[model samples]
Target: MHPALVEEFKSVDAVIASDARTAGVDAFALSLLKVERQARRFVTYLVFQYPCFGRSDVPALRKTLSDSKKVYFEGILRGFDALYPQPLEALIGAEYAHLKARVDEAELHRNKLFHGQLTEESLSRAQLLEFVVDMRRWCELLCDAGQQELGYAGFGSSSFTKSPELTMSASFRIQMQGLADYDAFIKTVLRRPQGQQAQ
Candidate 1:
């Protein structure tokens, strides 16, 4: 995994267990947003076939997904849906409805938190942390799906694993097949209609 993600994994561990409830709330909320952004970046990478090695600051990705206002999580979902319109089990041997559900659920809390309207009654620390953890799991599931269906040579999958230790033990490397052939394959996939790409 990248150094920044390694540090973020450690920070999340601390916030999840921290006794500083007030600060933990802010940290957890911010972490939730980070997870959402990471999900968007993954979708962007899959669309453009870019391997970013777990970083989210890619210029081309930002430019592609840029909007006058903030990009909506559902908007990213629409692009992903367009890319893979078939039932996931038909392609990746998995069901991803849960991933979409998790994203939708997180969006609700995300809006409330960002607007400073989320309260203890509406979303407790335990609930907030649950969303963060679940969203992280969502990212991991998507990564696994990408590798299974697209033959993507990704190594950062371990960075999303759950652990109790605050150490960055996950080692990751980004790999790709022949650059020319891969580029052609991505172009072919983009050209085909939804669910009609040759496997």
Candidate 2:
């Protein structure tokens, strides 16, 4: 029900519809389950990677990702927004719902962590590992979604196969690199303090 989730859901639905069309499926049934799964994967990754993210930071992160998602969705929506009209529009709507639910859930989980209701034991190292793995998976999914949309628009897979053009524009590459930096930061935090260095 959160606006962030709503935006992401819409973006993802647009992406899937775009893919299906490109794949040449005529009557694809929009799968809310799949969209929900994708949304969960994304939120889980965010929460796991940035447990320290505060309410103040949530808006910025949500805004940035939402804007990115919208740009990508619009790009795909441009050519096929009218084709198969009903399904395309439906996909967009569903994605919005999916993302909204995800953002709401994530905010709740984040609040729990912030309030000390959650503990490291409650979210183990394995969970953190899984979160990173899922993050990579979601990134791949987003990339694939873009590729699929392009494919639907008559561009071959190759068209979308290269590194995302958006990722390189205007120091976005630095932002992307920050994802890795964040992982290192987490690892550093998990380590024993230098004063208590392990023998």
Best by lDDT: 1
Candidate 1 local lDDT, 30-146, one digit each (tens) = 666666565455444454443322344344334433522334555444444544444333442344566556656766665666677754366677766776666565555554565
| lDDT by candidate, in order shown | 0.48, 0.34
Worst 10-residue stretch by lDDT in candidate 1?
A: 166-175
Q: Estimate each model's TM-score.
A: 0.55, 0.25
Q: Candidate 2 residues 91-122, lDDT tens each?
A: 43435454444433433444465476774346
Local error of candidate 1 at residue 82 (angstroms): 0.8
TM-score of 2: 0.25
Off by over 4 Å in 2: 1-107, 119-121, 150-199
Q: Per-residue lDDT for 1 in model 1?
A: 31
